[model samples]
Target: MVGRFTRGLRVVDDSVDVFRDNPRLAILPLLSLLSIGGAFAIVLGTALRYGAVSSVLTSDLLQYAAIFVAIAVSSSVGTFFNAAVVHCAFQYFDGKETSVRGGLAAAWQVRRKIALWSVTAATLGTVLYIIDENFGALGSLARVLFDLAWGLLTFFVIPVLVLEDTKGLRPLLQESGTAFRETWGESITASLGISFVFFPVGVIGLSVLGWAYLFASGVPALLIGSAGFIVLVAAMVAAQVLGMVARTALYRYAVADEKVGPCAGRNPETIFPSD
Candidate 1:
């Protein structure tokens, strides 16, 4: 676990440098977040129309169905945006100017793949969520373990969907899982390293923002504090974008066995150690 954590940190460090080197790439994730928010708002608003949220929450079938559908639609939108991010990241990695238009266009070109992958991801996500909502002590453990397993297997699915010459879902998923198993530590460490980097930053930012919000009793001060919240949220989005790039770097290394992101002059093999 310690070694895996170290691997994850290396990915994290490299990701930070990549984002710093290509600050413009942050625009892709920012746009993705806006798209996701808009898409989810529409989907969720439609779902809420089925019945009152209180009623939906209480009825087992209605609640589960509502939540599942909402999750699936939201996940699909997220997957779509993520594929766009992958395209932009790869383009930037290869020494090209990344464009939002081209990224979205490429994502549209492969919409079917995004939808199929979203089905798999959303199903797993909804099931794990349901497991937590419905079960007891055992269910919590199951949810955690299931999430961990799913994370490992699908970590590179978006990148594969974008970069690999594969044509079908079966091969994409199978190849991603195989690669993940062979380079498990890198994936975990990447996740761990990202969390490690973000946890404190998030806490500190939110804490400071919260204090500012508390002290701002006047309307103008309150507006300033609200803007601070927006900054905090934007920072969080940047952190997420950083993680996605880091994950993509690891995927590139795992698949191509080459220098990537922050690890650019170093030995690529060290980044994807099996043991």
Candidate 2:
């Protein structure tokens, strides 16, 4: 197995290839729409069932806990689905036949690793939250640093776990390290590029919607709000799709450059014959 530090370095450089390839762009919007809709429905249902929103606003601790749990579960499922979609995109990018069925099957094959990574991420996030809430000024600074480091370091964990069928912390760490070292700069650049394109459009659209909402009332509000919501949702879906595509491109690049292990199944040459 490759060392974590080396893998991290490779990931950084591979990010450039990921963005350039744009492997999963075509399917991202559909996947994003499904994920968002599913997540919304789950969260909304939980809120209605337990009056979570009202209770949380009223500062009820128990209600807040329940709401948090609901949100976490829903978000987890959404993430799993998204991971599956990205995995499928990788398969397709590698010139394999990829359908939703194949993606789900692949996801199931590595569900344990995905779940472990998710749990680990959630725990780390909770720890940071707790430190931020209870600690002094220095503690807060430490939390920020922790998050920043993890954010950069763990960028490739999903791709590694899902695409490579990697298990345990060791593989995850190794792949993440390789990805970071090889492609961090490129990944950051691609993210910035995507943000630059999407953020301005979102801001302008939202600002216009806000003004229209303030000026309108009754049926007009309904009409304009509905239209704005649709547009915003569409934009969000597009952005997510673009992000997945970019990430996929970066992952393939990292794999190629680092000559990391073969993907989940099949012989190495089947995917990259020259290797």
Highest TM-score: give the candidate number: 1
Model 2 lDDT tens row, 1-275: 12333333333334334433544443544664676567778877987898767766676455445445544554466556667667766765666666666666766787777677766666666666667767889879999899788878877776777777565888788887787677665566555555655666677667657866899888887777777766666556555655555566667766674232122332223332221
Ten contiguous residues minimizing lDDT sum, candidate 1:
266-275
Cα deviation at 59, candidate 1, in Å, is 1.7
RMSD of 2: 8.2
Score candidate 2 by TM-score against the native.
0.71
Query: How far out, in Å, is residue 39 in model 1?
Result: 3.6
RMSD of candidate 1 to true structure, Å: 3.0
**Model 2 stretches with alpha carbons more than 4 Å out:** 1-71, 258-275
